[model samples]
Target: MSLEVLQVSKQYGTQLAVDQVSFSARPGQVLGFLGPNGAGKSTTMKVAAGYILPDAGDVLIDGISILTHPIEASRQIGYLPEHNPLYMEMYVVEFLLFVAGLYQLHGAEARQRVAGVIHDCGLEKEQHKRIGALSKGYRQRVGLAKALVHDPKVIILDEPTTGLDPNQLVEIRALIRKVSQYKTVILSTHIMQEVEAVCDEVVIIHEGKLVAQDSLKALKQNTTEVVFVLETQEEMQSKWFDDLLGLAKCHLISPTTIRLEAKEVFLLRTELMQVLNSHGLTLISLRQEERSLEHVFYELTAPRYNV
Candidate 1:
């Protein structure tokens, strides 16, 4: 694993912002850190970056505990904070150079590093403009450029896509996806669609506690699957009674529609027809509904844990 967090928690007075959350990530994988606003996603990322100390537990990078070696851990992790802060008075290229200098690069090497990121992050045109003069999308690119200039192995981005236009969102997402080829990327976002767009696995926190950690597909599989609709006709429920008999799960909606699995649809309709005919029920319609990530996100994060 490139990174590991063991039982981490953060408390501000009586309020616990993060509680015993643990997970791992390696190069070539993007982990989505998902939760609602104020759900400790930012706190967790800050702790991982060594910007804030956890009240308990450990954060490690490549087997080295960050608490004991903040500099080494920081050298390995590139963090773009939730706000994407940049000095409004500084030009994009100048800011990149400053960040590069912090990483100990100098002379030609520093200039090359800054230039590489300017192109890599699509900040070429805005490179000479003061950050305060750039549009929100361009400014976000500068924030990302600074994070990438040092070539860190672990990238931690908090709501990296916020305030971006649709085209900019796609562009930035592509950039992140490309970088995942050689580094571990941890992204925090409430946009469920972005999770599907780039992340390989997802770790969800709710009320300062870990609630889910799994592949998106795996999470969906574990959630209950039920189709709900109006109850169909009585006569439809009686036909093919024996043939349509064994369904593992089925749900009836209001008195005219039926919701069922695709495999069971035909059999269910036949059997339901028989049952309906016997009981004077009439069938109106039937349909299929599959669960979505939005539903699963809500389900996992809905419960409150009073940490």
Candidate 2:
């Protein structure tokens, strides 16, 4: 493991932002730090990056404790926070060089790392622009580049894809995949597709408490629920699905769509298509949903309705 968060906790006055959360991140794979907003994802990451002192426990970057060896551990860890804080007045290349200088990287090494991140982060085109003038997506790239410029063994990115367009998303995902081959990466995000797209393993927190930690496959396999969504060109009637037998529940999302859930798999799909056909409705789309991290996340983090 390149990064280890050992029973870390943080409190903001009376409010406990993180409650003894613990997880490890291995190199050669992306570890997803998954949770709903305000679930202490950012705070935990800040503690690990040595940006804040934890109220309890410790974080290790390549085995150096952030609590005991703050300076030494920080040197081995790079963090791009949820809010990409940048000096607005500085040019992209200037800002990166400034960051390198703060890390005591001088002369040839500074130039080399700055150059490396600019190319790796796809920021070559935007490198000359002033930080204030760049678009949100490009700024995000700059922040990521800054995190990579140091070439730390551990990288923590909190919601790194916040401002990216679809094309940019693909490029950044590929970049992350490439970098994680040699370094440990902790990716924090609420977007299920982002986690599914890039993460190899997962660590989830709920209400500041450690909830689930496992391989992506294991979390997905823990559930047996099957979901199938049906979309039609014409508005679907609720009564049409009222008498469906095999389904555990039928939820009409809108006039043109319905979500069907079942405890068992297989025949529910066949029955659904047959019904739509019998009703003379043209099928626009029908897709059986996989047990996605999104579903698993909901189960783990959903609020208590009973309360």
Candidate 3:
């Protein structure tokens, strides 16, 4: 594993911000860290990046414990915080050089790395501009450039696309995918589309607890209830769908439209078609509803007992 959080926990006064949260990420994997506000995503990322100490447990980067060897662990990780802080007065290249210098890189090596990141992050056009004059998208690119300047093995980003417009969002997401080609990346974001677009695995935290963690495909496949929408020419009563095989529940959305819930949508489809044919009901349209990541997120994070 390139990164691992072993039973990590954090507390501030009486409230426990994080409670024994644990997860791991391997090289070349992009893990989406998801949670509602104040679910301790940021705190956990901070601990993983070695920016703060955990009250208990520890974080490891490439088998090195962050708590025991903070500097050494940090050297292998690149972190872009939720609130990106930068020297507004510094030029893009100047700032990158400054970050390179912190790693004790100098002369030709430092220049080369800065240039590499500038090209990799799509900052070549804006590299000579002052940080204060750049747009939010460009500024974000600069922050990402700074994070990648040292060629770290692990990358952590918090709300990386918080305020980006559609075009910027696509660009940044592409950059993240490019970076993950060789590094382990863990990013927290509320945008479900972003997760669908880039993340291979997802870790969801709710109330400072690890509610769920799995590959994106597994999460969708394991969903307990699969919904299907059907439209027909004739009106259908709620009781018409009650006896259908494999159906868990049914709802009459309109006189001619119905929604069916089942464990296996494929089975439900076949059974539904047979029933419709037997009853001579003309089927106008029938389709399996596509489940979105937002729906999965709510199902896991909702306050109700049944998930």
TM-score of each: 0.80, 0.81, 0.81
Off by over 4 Å in 1: 222-225, 229-288, 303-307
**Model 3 agreement with the true structure over 1-307: per-residue lDDT tens digits:** 3899999999999999999999999888899999999899999999989999999999989889987788889989999999998999999999999999999889999999999999999998999999999999999999999999998999999999989999999999999999999999998999999999999999999989999999999887734467777899987776767777677766666778776778765655477777787767898987777677776786677543210
Span of 10 residues, lowest total lDDT, candidate 2: 298-307
- The TM-score of candidate 3 is 0.81
Can you write out model 2's per-residue Cα lDDT over 129-171, one digit (the tens) per residue?
9999988878888998899888888889999898689988887
Model 3 has an lDDT value of 0.88
- Every candidate's lDDT: 0.80, 0.85, 0.88
Task: Indicate the worst ten consecutive residues by lDDT in candidate 1.
Answer: 235-244
Ranking by lDDT: 3, 2, 1
Q: Point out where model 2 deviates above 4 Å.
A: 225-289
Give the TM-score comparing model 2 with the true structure, all chains together: 0.81
Order of quality (TM-score): 3, 2, 1
Q: How much is the lDDT of residue 142 in candidate 2? A: 92
